[model samples]
Target: MIIRKDNLLLLPEVYLIIASIFYWVNTSTLFNPFAIIFIGVLLYQVIIKNKIAGLLISSVFILLNLYMVLALISELSEFTTSNNSFIRLLVFGVLFLGLNLIASIFMFKKHLVK
Candidate 1:
């Protein structure tokens, strides 16, 4: 069986979907439209092997996650008093940032290097 390298791009989407579900559960939000919209677009772009589209989608996610990371850091003290919530937010923010960064870098290399 041969494995396609492009399939690896699904990793970030899966993580984002799971994270969105958790966010909904935690906040009791009705839905997360951004997750649905962005992940769907990213999946399509990846399937079609469109490097530019994939990079752009992943870059958008990266920016969103970066904003979350910065906001979390800025309000660190607000949650620090509550260890459980603070840890949860920190982990979620960092993981989201890291996963998007990885996807963006992968797309960048694929788009620019070869």
Candidate 2:
């Protein structure tokens, strides 16, 4: 049976929730870059798959990622006593963007296959 949009949408949210829990427990920079890709994935699901649920999910993803990025940059500025945090953030940001692009490409390929 085809999966319902409601159920499909939950998958990425669940991933984000788990990541959030891990971040909280570790106390290691709350907004690690993977979260942005999660937002992009959710957006792809909503936009490409035409799921109505994606509208709300995409909005949340956009807002959350924006806040996270801003907060991360602000914290990096405060932590400027050492450049390590800034470097790490830059590396992770690039990695996240790369991963998001790759995932988007794969998703597009899958769409073409079907």
Candidate 3:
């Protein structure tokens, strides 16, 4: 289908909305699915298209994935924490993921507008 330039804003906005809801709801898993898909797409861009922007975003995506995986593993293993610090970390991680996704949106917009 045709993707309008203005409509392109919806991609990042949707990510922002989901992240906001997860943060407000005291949940941290919302970004993981998006991260997984993003990682694959970034890799495709890097390997097939040799896109320079994909390199940086892919690195950021991996870091975000690492944080999520660690948090998940700790929770799954019943690792105890004195406070809800891990939850906070997860929230921050999701925030960064959203920010990076937002940045990628701008980068894409730049190329598309050119």
Poorly placed runs, candidate 2 (over 4 Å): 1-50, 93-114
Among these predicted structures, which one has the highest lDDT? 1
Q: After superposition, how far is residue 100 of candidate 3 from its true place, in Å?
A: 0.7
Model 1, residue pairs in steric clash: none
* Residue 99 accuracy (lDDT) in model 2: 43
**Per-candidate RMSD vs. true structure?**
3.3, 8.7, 11.7
- TM-score-based ranking: 1, 2, 3
- How much is 55 displaced in model 1, in angstroms? 2.3
TM for candidate 3 is 0.32
Q: How does each model score on lDDT?
A: 0.65, 0.54, 0.54
lDDT of 3 by residue, 69-95 (tens): 677566645637635776776676566
lDDT score of residue 86 within candidate 3? 69
Estimate, for each residue in 1-114, the C-alpha lDDT of model 1 and write its tens digit: 776765564565555556655655666656667655755775576467575675676677677767877787887767538687788877877776677567666555666554
lDDT of 1 at 94: 76
Clashing pairs counted in every model: 0, 0, 0
Q: Superposing every Cα of model 2 onto the true structure, what RMSD results?
A: 8.7
What TM-score does candidate 2 reach?
0.42
Against the hidden reference, what TM-scores do the models get?
0.65, 0.42, 0.32
